[model samples]
Target chain A: MLDMPFIRIIEGLNHTLENVIAPEVESTLAKGQLFAVVEILKQISGRFDHKHELIVEDIQVSQQMLTTLIETFTAAAIDIPDEFQANTETIDATAMSGEQLRQQRDRLEIIVSAALDLLNSHRAEIVDAQKVEHTVFMQLGKNLFRNMLLVSQHRFDKISQLDKED
Target chain B: MALADNSRLASYLAEKLGGSELSISKEWQNTEGWSMETFSLDVEYTKGGNKIEQAIILRRQPVSGLLEPYDVSIEYRILSALQASKVIVPETFWYEADPAVLERPFYVMEKVPGDVHFVTQNSDPDYRLIADDDERASLAEDFIDNLVHIHQSDWKSLGLDFLGDPGPGKNSALQQIDYWSDVIERAGVRAKPLVTLAVNWLRTNAPETDQVRLVHGDYRTGNFIYQHSHITSILDWEMTHLGDPHEDLVYVLGALWRSPAPTDWVCHLLSEEDFLSKYEQRSGISVDRDKLNYFQLLLDLKAVGIMATAANAFAQNKTEDLKPAAFGSILDLAYAALAQHLNERLSSC
Candidate 1:
C-alpha cells in the first residue's frame, strides 16, 4: 500500500525517457523508439490503477489483526485506547474508494504498530505477552505471504545491462 | 548533468600526471554498482619523454540512489589505508571533491584486473556460481583470508579513525540500529509494523562486542574479483566502518547471495559449516550463535531500509536511472522476507 501509484510510476518513466535519455541518444532510430515508448505509456496511463481487490484484501487482513490485538488486550486486562478502537471501526471496505481504503489501511497499520510498542514496553505487567506477540507475528507473516504472491521474480542481472557487451 | 565527460577527464588526468599530451583511449561506466557511479577509463599519456598507458577506475557519487548522501572520499581513504596491509584492494590515486569537474564528487584508483561474478552467472543445473572445483576452493580460501585480515586490521595505526569507532560493549550494535533506523525514517516511508517490531526487539536484545575491529561493511562473494584461481582484489568498500566482526560473517551467510537448492553452497564456494570452521580457525574468534541470530534480523531490517531508500529516491524524481525504480518495486518482497524471518524467530522464542 505504501508503494507508488501505477500512474505516477508511468509518469516517471516517461519523464526520464524524454528529459534524461533522449538528448543523450545519438541514433535517430533509437531516439524515435524511445519517444514512441513514451507516447505509448502516456496513452495507457489513464487505464491503469492498482487492483482494488488487493487493497480491500489488505484492509480485511489488518482488521483481523486488530481484532486479535483487542481480544489479547482484554484477556490481559490491559487498557485499549479509544483512538485504536475508533480507527478499527472506521475500516469499512465497502464504503471507501481504493485510495481511501489504502489510506485507512495505512492509518490502522500505524495504530497497530503503536499498540505493539506499548505492549512491548509493559510486557512484564501483561500475562502471556509472548503468546500475544507470537499471534501478531503470525498474522504479519500471513499478510506478507499474500502480498509476496503478487510480486514477480526479479531479474536484477538485466537492470544494469551488465551481461550485454557494448 | 552528463554522467561522464571523457575530454574533461583526460585533461584532469594530464595535469595530475604531469603529462603534456594525454587522452582517454577507452572509457565505460560500470552500471553493475548500484551505489556509486563507476567508470573504467583506459588512459594513454606522455610523461618524461615516455609514453605510458594505465587502466584507471573512477568512482563518483550518484545524485541519489541506495545509500544516499554519499561521500566517495571515505571509500577512497579506506582503500588508501589498506594499500600496505595484507588486504588486497585497488590502489587509490586521487580524490576530487570539486563538483565542477565531474558534476559530483569522485575519486580515481587503479583498475584491478579480474572478473567480478554476478549472481546471474550461476546458470548451471545445480546453480553453481563457480563451476570449477579447484578455482572455487582457491577463491574461497582468499575470500576467508581477506575477511580475516580485514577484521584483524589495526585501524588506529592506519589513521582510519575518521571512520569513527563505536567504542566498546554494545555500542557497535546500538550504533548500527540507530544508523539503519534513521535511514528508514529519512526515506519517508510509513513504518511497517514488522519493522517497528524488529527494531524494538533489536534494541532490547543487542549483543555486546568486547573487541572491535575494522569490519568490511559489505563482505560477500560478488564484491570480490578473481583471475584464474586467485582473488585479485576486494571491491566495494562504500559501507566500510568500525563494528562487530560478526556483522560481516552474517552478511556472508545471507540467503540472498547463496546458491539455490541442490548446490546449497554459501557464496557458491563452500558449505556453511566449512565457511564457519575456516573463519574460526583463521581468525581465532569463536562464532557466537546468539549474536549471529541477532545480526540476521538486523540484516533483514537493513535490507528494508535500503529498499525503501531506493523507492523514495525514485518517488521523489531524484534520479533518472530506472534501476532504483526497479529496486523500489521489490520493497514488498523485502518486507515479506523480513516478516517471515520475524515469525520464525518469534516462534522459536
Candidate 2:
C-alpha cells in the first residue's frame, strides 16, 4: 500500500490511545475525542492505501491536459513563446514515485498555467476565442471531475464530525 | 509552556484587574482551529469592595499557523471599534502584545455563553442543537440581522480607516485581489494551473464596489456561538478587514460551506433566497450577482492559499497538530472547486 509506512505510525498512535490514553483519561470530552482520533486514524489509514494511485492518476490526467493545452493554443494560431514551450514533454508516470510524479505534474502545470494566462489576456483579440476557451474549459472539467471523484471517495465527513466537541 | 493554565491565568487576571482575592472556577484549553490557541475559563474575584464573577476566553497566536503571522492587537482593535456598532461581538478587556506575559501575544474577551455549532463534521454534545423549527427560524433571522448590521455600518466613521482604504471605486476588488495573491504567493505551494487561471480570472473581471465595509473574511458557519436558538456572539475576527460587503455575502452563500440539509441551508439555518433577500432588505443594498461571482472566486482562492500554508507547515514539521495536516489534504478539493467555478464562468463568458 502507498501509505503503508505512514499507516504504521497512525496505527501506533491508535493503539496507544486505545490501550494507554483512554484508560487514563478522566474527562469525557478528552476520552471521546481520543476514540474519535482512533477512528479517524483508521479511516486515514484505509484512505491512504489508494491515495498514491489517485495521485498518480491525477498527475497523468494533468500531464495529458498540459500537452493538449499547448496543442490547442497552437491550433488556434496563438504564438507559443519559447519559455512557455519549456517542459511540454509528456511525463512517464510509471517510472516516477508519487513524490516525483507530483513534482513533474507541478512543473507541467506551471507551464500550462502560463499559457492559460496568456490565452485569457489575449482572448478578446482572437477571432476563434470561443474555441480556445472551450478547449481550456474541457481540460479544466477533466481535472475538476477527477478531483470531485477522489474527494467523494473520502470516508471521513470533515464537516459533520470535526466540531462535535464545540 | 502552558502559561494559560487555571491558576496562572487567574493570577495574571487578578493583577490585571487590580484585585487580590481571585480564583479560577473553571479553565480549559480548546484544541480546535489551527490558527490560534483558545482557552475558555471563568474567573471570580473581589473588586472595589465587591465580589464579581466573569467568564472569559483567551486567544493567543500559536508558534505556527495556516496564514501569515499576525499580531493579536489587530483583532483587538477591530473588536474595540465594533463595540458601539450594531454588529454583535464579544466585549474585549485586555491585550498583551509582549511575549513576556505569555509565550506569545494574547488577548482576553468575554466568554460568551453558547457554543459554535458545526453540524457538518462534528457530533459534540456541547453545542446547542436546534431541533425546533421556530428556534431555527429565529436564529436565521438573527444571523442575517448581524450580517446586515456589519455591512451597513460606516466603517470609515467608526475610526476603522486604518484598515487600508482601498481608495475609491473598484479599488476594493483590486485590493482584495492583491492581498490574497500575496498570501498565495507567500504560501509557496506547488503552482497549479487551476489557481493561476482563477487568479487571472479574478483580475480580468474584478468588480467595482460603491461602499467599503468591514469584511469578515471568514464569515461562515462554525464561527458563531448560539444559545436558546439565539446567536450570542460572532467570533473569530482574525481575518477581519475593510472591503466590499459582497465578499462577506459571498462567503456566507458559498457552496463550500453548505450543509447537507434540504434546500442546502446557507449556514444550516437560512435558505439561499431567504439569506440574500433578508440581506438586501435589511442592508438596503441590492445584491450584485456579478460582484458575488467575482468574490466567490476570490474566496475560493483564499481557501486554497490557506490550505497551501497548512500543508506546508505540516510537511515541514512546523506543527505536530493533525488539524493543519488534515486541512492540507483538502487542497485538491479546493482546487477542483476553483477549477469548476472557473470553467463555469469562462464557458459562460
Please compute DockQ, using alpha carbons, for every candidate against the native two-chain complex: 0.63, 0.31
Residue B291, candidate 2: C-alpha displacement in angstroms: 2.2
Q: What interface root-mean-square deviation (Å) does model 1 yield?
A: 1.8
Q: What is candidate 1's TM-score against the reference?
A: 0.94
Tell how far residue B153 is off in model 2, in angstroms: 1.0
> B151-256, model 1: which lDDT tens digit per residue?
9888889988899889999899999999999998888653567887888778877899999889888888889989989999999998888989999999999887
Question: TM-score of each model's B chain?
Answer: 0.96, 0.93
Highest DockQ among the candidates is held by which one? 1
Consecutive 10-residue window with the lowest summed lDDT within model 1 chain B: B119-128
Write the residue-wise lDDT of candidate 2 on B309-340 in tens digits: 77666555566555665676667777776776
Candidate by candidate, in order, the iRMS in Å equals 1.8, 5.3
Per-model CA lDDT versus the true structure: 0.83, 0.73
